[model samples]
Each structure stands twice: as C-alpha cells, then as structure tokens.
Target: MTAYAVAHLRPAARLDDEVFEYMERIQSTFAPYGGAFLVHGTTPEVLEGQWPGGLVVIGFPTLHDARDWYESKAYQEIAPLRTRHLAGDVILVDGVAPGYDASLTAARMREAQEA
Candidate 1:
C-alpha cells in the first residue's frame, strides 16, 4: 500500500537560513526511500474551515518506506532545522487499497462497538 508523510506547518514568522538549508537538502534524503513530495508546503483552498498554515505531503512506496525515511539518519540530521523554526504536526499513514469501500469500515466499526 502507498504511505504518506503529512505535515501541517504553522506559519513561520520568518524563513531563516537554516530553514532554507533544510529545504535545499530535504530532497536528497528522499531518493533512498522512494519518497516524493506530493505537496510541498502549499497553501490550500479553504472550502470549509479556516486553514492555519500550509500543508506538506510526501508519498512513499509503502508504509515501511515511509517509516524508514522518517527514521533515517539523513532526515534526522536535518529535521531540527525545521523543528526549531516551525511548529506543526507530522504523521505517517497508510493509504487505502484500490476498490476500498467506506461500508467495510462502517461494518468493522459496528462490530467493534458491539463487542
């Protein structure tokens, strides 16, 4: 299954040299794990609620690849560059398979609740 690294980054007061450096070096860390940016800190169109900041999404070949990329030394080294300057949330999640249905999830949830 495909996996994703999703980040919701709050607005930075300023983009310092460190942040720029992190941006410059981030792509290098991805190639080893087959990670690619699906969305690179892009401002989203607000259809419903107000969006606090930009969204970043990286797609990986699988959940293991996503985990490996996040835990890899290269990424760890540059993570602080952004962490120190930005406040946000990052999570890795697996994408649903082809022909997935919400009804299947609903059935599972119903069974769990009954249990």
Candidate 2:
C-alpha cells in the first residue's frame, strides 16, 4: 500500500528562503525512497481555522518507506531547517486505507455514467 505525507507550513520570521532551500535538498534525499513531490506550496484562499501558510504533499511507495525516508540520516540533517522556518505547524499525515486505486474509482464512475 502506498503512503503519503502532507505537510502544512506556516513560516516563522526570517525563515522562508532558508526553508525553501532546505526543502529542495530534502527532495533530493527522498529520491532513493521512491518519493514523489505531489504538491508544493499551493496557496489556499479559504483560510478557515488555523490554516498554515503553505502546503506540501508527498507520495511514497509505502508507509514504511515514508517513515524510513523521514528517519534517514540525510533527511534528519536538513529537517531542522524546516522546523526553524515553520512556527511548528509542520505535520506528517498518513494516507488512509491501502493503495489508492484512483483508476478503479474512475472506471466505476464511467460505468455509472454508461448505466
């Protein structure tokens, strides 16, 4: 089953550029774990609740893969920079259920349409 990590970032003062730079480096480190950057910094207009200023979503092959990438020494080295930038709103959420079968879901939708 695939796993995902969704991060919400609210930058602290004087940390935007540094954090952005660090994130680039982080992406490089995640390559070996079959991680893909799904969304990076998509601004939200609907600011309901205590919304973070920025968002990042990453997809990994599995939950263990995601965890391994995070715990890896390479990521740990650069993680502090991300922490320093955000006012501590960074979160890693796992994707619910096993393997997202979007194609099957789409096919079902098409079948319904044909019906």
Q: Which structure among the candidates has the greatest TM-score?
A: 1
Error of 2 at 51 (Å): 1.8
Task: Please write out the lDDT profile of model 2 over residues 18-115, one tens digit for every residue.
Answer: 77779679888888999999988678676567665777788998888888898999989998877765754444556767666989989999999999
lDDT, residue 54, model 1 = 88
RMSD of each: 1.2, 6.9
State the lDDT of candidate 1 residue by residue for 56-109, as single tens digits.
999999999999999999999999999988888999999999999999999999
> What's model 1's lDDT at 64?
99
